[model samples]
Target: MNPLYISQKLFEHYEHIEEVKHYYGLLAIYALLLTAEEKQDPVLLGKCKTVLSRFPDHIQHPRYNFPSYRIGGIPKAYSLMKDYLPEAEEQVRYYAEEMLTASRDRKGIMSYPYAPEKELIWIDVAMAVTPYLLFAGLALGDEKYIDEAAKQTFLMYEEFLDQENGLLHQSKNWAGPGKYSEDHWGRGNGWGYLPLAELVQHLPQHSRHRTKAEKYFKDLSASLLPYQSERGLWRQEIPFEYAYEETSGSGLILYGMGVGMRTGLLDREKYFPAFKKGIEALNQICINADFSTERSCPGCLCPGDGEEKGTVKAYVTLMLPHRDEHHSFAPLMFALVEAYRNGIYDLPRDSH
Candidate 1:
């Protein structure tokens, strides 16, 4: 039941290794964990600030990049600790400018705007920027940031969600209409879930916008439950039972569900079991300690044919998904913290 100890160990081990691209998301996780522990560990906080500061100037120069926007969530960590670390205020500003710019460029009148050809559109881009948007609004005391967040947030729900099934999808391709699978994809659902569960905390409860978002989130959590694998993990493709399960997606689900329960939006009696299953799967993955965690199904914005030569080529060349354990590690640890805090699982006595 010592979540603080477990979280500290998980974070320390990961921070020491510090593999490159994983840093931003993991720092976001650490920010959540530290805030939960109710102690401000400046060392971890400093490490987090260093990672966020380095992003705009990264050799890869993610500032204007689509994938770079994914780091937008990191500012939430800064916003959590900004009063203690005043310097983080500047980093939050820097990230907000870039993310808001991206959202505007991609926004259209009747539909969400697309980012050129290969670039990320609203769904993917919004997932990346949502954390920062919420943070900027609170940190700077700027209603504009919150208003923009609401507008962009609405765009994501408008375009990506499959109205019939009530689950969210990535996007529709430019050249042709896009197809969403019968079941939700784990990561996309994860992306959708977190913003609703966490960011909604900052919005005024009585506002019409928050009420709409809560309804959407409730439906999303309900829709995602049936897709949970018997083993407590979510498959890369929820409807495609044959596809592999991905740990990062599962962890994000746990984060979302746990946040839901914490906020009283999700009915714990109905949804807690699903959340528990998610944690059980995550704990197993951690105990397994596979270096790569579990391989994620390749990232594809569109569901492509496994058949055609061109489709296969596209899946191999463009949609080829790669998996790294770094993403899985931090989220798993964060979920563990949530589980412990919720007292969902009882730790057994030592086997010895």
Candidate 2:
């Protein structure tokens, strides 16, 4: 299917969706902004500017109520729209400072800002915080932000990565100090991997973090290759054979692989078949004619409460897939954008 057509339809659908002030909505907004910039479509870019204008500045934004991490996409969106939005620089700097000063564990890894008392560190934070910081740092000519962006991803990878399998656990401290969630969650790995991919793509060639980031990204990509289902998707619980095929995680993974191929960090010969199959599968199964999405896991963080919390069983059982979840939109858009970049576009049948 034509990636641009599908993306436009999805962007239009997102324009009318309500309650988009949170991370999920922000992610979709960021994806649309990225798409507009990539295609250089003035009309699409104008729509993105309108969408971004709806939010107030970073401090007064409703997303700040939860935690600083959730607002990563906000600054990321602003960074892209800096030319159009006069407040973009201020907003990006504000969030960069928030990330710099945010609470962290003894190891200096960023903790969940919502509950600093708990000192929780999760895979999700990689995606939530890293890219924006990298962008802001690059945009503002602040190396500290860039350092922190690389530092967070490297530290979290060292913490949560399972040496046995190369997959990362979803979170730490949810069960107890030094304890990690049991499952190799699909989306969790995506959260962890995507930032590394971003670093590989954006970090300067001679930057100190460049070599290590590329290695970590390549390592994770290799680890993930073995898990793709025959249908070109990943399961809800990645290593679990019985787990159902999931879209968001699959899309995120594919997006990373696409970046890898484009950047020469990953071997296209080794990865392109999977990437092709994945984008095609996502277009065929997840995105509908009207641009709604399906089979994306809902917002989940260590899933269950009480005894069931942070268990592998809980991850597979409690976090079932659903249709039209907001989380699905950005991931699908990311994969499609990457696919378009790689010259994989095919015209939709109806367009013919």
TM-score of each: 0.77, 0.93
Candidate with best TM-score: 2
Clashing pairs in 1: 298-321
Q: What would the per-residue lDDT of candidate 1 be over residues 1-352, giving only the tens digit for each residue?
A: 3544445555555555654444345444544444444435566556555655554446353333443334434543344445644655665666566555553433441233354443334254455555556667767776666666666666776667877767676554432434323335666677777667656666766555687778777788887777888888776655566666677677777877777787888888988888887776665553343223444444455445543312323323443234444655555665666776567544322312
* Candidate 2 residue-wise lDDT, 1-352, digit = tens: 5787687777677656755557667777777877887888988878777666655543345535335434445445345435556556766778688778888988998887788888898988888778878888888889998999999999999899999999999899988777788989998999998889889988889899998999999999999999999888999999998998999899899999999999998999999999999988888888877787789999888878777889989988998888788788888888888999998878353311
What is the lDDT of every predicted structure here? 0.57, 0.82
User: What is the Å distance of residue 264 in model 1 from its true position?
Assistant: 0.7
lDDT of 1 at 53: 54
